[model samples]
Target: MATRQKIALVTGANRGLGLEIARQLGKRQMTVLLGARNAAAGEAAAAGLVAEGIDASAILLDITDGASVSTAVQTVTEKFGYLDILVNNAGILPKLTEEGSPSQASPQLLLDYLQTNFLAQVSVTQVFLPLLKHSTAGRIVNMSSSIGSVTIASEPLHQNGPKPPRLPYAASKAALNMFTVLLAKELRPEGIKVNSADPGLTQTDAGGPNAPYTVEQGARPAVWLACLDDDGPTGCFFTHVDEHVVNNPW
Candidate 1:
């Protein structure tokens, strides 16, 4: 039998780091699916990739909505049969004002961040596991942040260097990192790799225009993790800043 072609799904791929990650994966000759909450945006992003000579398509998937996620899974099943990679890159960082400090932040604020970042990611992963397991090499990359580092957060100058802690967002991603570790352990025997990728401060709308790194640079870590070899390390946290040199521990 011929080798099955790899298929990758990247959520929130209509723009920014997620889009860049999708493009890089497509450039590797794999079929790339851009998952967006908005159909038009996803379609346009996929079209852009297709114009660049990549095999790409759009999937309307709202990670926070269970129905939307199920429909996305069905679409993937019907169109591709199996998924080789899943990048949980879609998440929200409510305004910093709403998350003043760990102490001042409201319970509602933390809950909101957890819903989109931590919990939604788990739900999506669970829903997609069946398809992922069908592949010879399955990989899961969770887009995380430096702020999620409990070690760094404790230091005066955290991974972001000199930035105030984003209580809600950071906490949510920390929980996500834990999920990556636990899931990786459970899926290891199945030849599946699960890891967290910290993009650091990138030049996205959320990262701000003046942020140090470009989207191309920020997306590298996730792309690298998504395409790891059979012998590659799993159940670890990586940052684009050091490029796998440092396997961050919570």
Candidate 2:
């Protein structure tokens, strides 16, 4: 019998780094599920990839919505039977003030960030873990940010540099890093590799126009982590350009 193709699910894949990551995986002959909140956007992205001769499909997924998450899981399970890789790329950065300060960041804003960036990621992982377990080589990649690094946040050099105005975004990523470590520890014995990746300051809708890198550059590290071998490192935080594990304070 012919071996089955790997299946990957990428959340927030309608555009930016997540879309690039899905494209890369599809190029490698993986069946990629492009998950986006907007059905039209998701379909357009998947169709674009298909036009480029990639095996890709779109799924409606709003990470903040439990119903959406469950439905996505069901759809994937029914279609693919198992999930080999999961890229948790959906996240939100709270609006920043003109002065680049998060002082005016409200409780609701922070909660919204946490819900999508941290809590929803956890929920999605839990929902897909069983399918991941069935794969011979399972991988989980969480899209974290360098700002999430407690080490970076506490460093004098970074502190003296441009401090981020939005504290909630940074805190949400930190929580994501914590989840990565905890989940890695829990799943390591099962031969599953889980890691967090920082895509760097890429020019995306969320990363802003002035951001230096492109979406492709930002997605590289995530693709790398999601395709790790069985012996690859787990519970590690990495950036795409450097491909070095970050010394986070998690």
Candidate 3:
């Protein structure tokens, strides 16, 4: 029998790090599903990849919405028999009152963060598991952050520690890490690899235009994790700072 072609779905791929990941995956000759909440943006991003001679198409997916998630799953099922890769890259940093600091942030603010970052991830994974299980080498890559590091957050002398803790965002990522560990353990028997990717501090709209790393540099690790072989490590944290090394657990 001929080897099955891979299909990858990347959320929030209309722009930023997600967009770069989709493009890189396409360069590997896989069919890429550029998922976005907005129809126009998703179409545009998919078109851009198509122009690069990639097999890419837009799938309207709002990870926070169950209806949208179901629709996306159905769409992919009808078009592609299975999904080889899933990148949960959609997230947000709430701008409500007392947003960044844990001390003053309201409970509602924290809930908002969990909804977009953590809860949505769980929902998306559960819905996609059946399709992922059908693949010979299934991979799930969760986009995490260094700010989520409990160790770094505890160090007062550390640059990130002195700054106001982006409490909700950081905590949500920590929860995501735990999810990566638990999910990997459960899926190991099935030969599926589940891991988290910390893109470091990249310059996306949320990270500010002046932030140090470009989107391309920050996206490399997630792309790497998504394409990991069967022998690759699962349920660990990694960053894009070094290509030679991987799974430097947080």
Candidate 4:
């Protein structure tokens, strides 16, 4: 029997780091399902990848919408039979006013962050998990930030540390880290690896121009996690550019 190609679903893959991650994974011979909220944009992204000889297709996946998520799950199931990799990369950065403080952050802002960054990830994982379970070695990579690291955030010397407060985004990622740990344990028996990847401060649309790293550099960690063999560690925080370095303060 011929072996089936692995299928990877990357959320918010129409642009920036998410797009790069999809591209790199596609290059590694995985059939990539590029998830985007905008139908036109998603199709364009998949077309771009196909133009480069990558086996890719667009899936209209608005992570915040339950119907859209369900549709995406069904579409992938019908097409791919199983999903081997899932990258939860969709997230929103809350705009803050002049030197905002966590204490002064609005309740609504926090709720919005939780809904998109944390809750949506949980929902997506729950929905796709059955298909992932079907794979012999499933991998779930959560796109997280070093800012979410309570240890790093608490430290005064670190760049993503707590000198400036990005309360909502940071808290949501910290919660995601917890999810990674919990889910990794829950799925370990089935040979599924769940981990959080800190792509670092890459100069993507999300990171702004001042950020030092490129999209390619930032995309590596998640891709690395996604392609890991059976011996690869799960339920840990790690960076791509950094060698064998597991991120701390998670």
Report lDDT (CA) for all predictions: 0.91, 0.88, 0.89, 0.90
Q: List the residue pairs that clash in candidate 3.
A: none
Question: Is 2 or 3 the stronger prediction by lDDT?
Answer: 3
What digit string (tens of lDDT, one per residue) describes model 1 on residues 59-173?
9999999999999999999988899999999999656566675678788888999999999999999999999999999999999987788887877566446455588898999
Whichever of 1 and 2 has more TM-score, that candidate is 1
lDDT string, candidate 3, 1-250, tens digits: 9888999999999999999999999999999999999999999999999999999999999999999999999998888879999999988854444564667766887898889999999999999999999999999999998778787666766554446667888889989989999999999999999999988778888777887888888898899999999899898888865554355546
TM-score of each: 0.95, 0.93, 0.95, 0.95
Candidate 4 residues lying further than 4 Å off, grouped into runs, are: 96-99, 158-162, 242-246
Model 1: lowest-lDDT 10 consecutive positions = 240-249
Q: For model 3, what is the alpha-carbon lDDT of residue 114?
A: 89
Which portions of model 3 miss their true places by more than 4 Å? 94-100, 159-161, 242-245
Runs in model 1 deviating more than 4 A are: 158-162, 242-246
Candidate 4 lDDT tens digits, 1-250: 9988899999999999889999999999999999999999999999999999999999999999999999999998898789999999989865555326878877888888899999999999999999999998999999999878998776768645545688888999999999999999999999999999988888887688998888888988899999999999999998854455355558
Model 2 stretches with alpha carbons more than 4 Å out? 98-105, 242-250
Worst 10-residue lDDT window for candidate 4 reads 240-249
Candidate 2's TM-score reads 0.93
17: Cα error in model 2, Å: 0.7
At residue 180, give the lDDT of candidate 2.
95
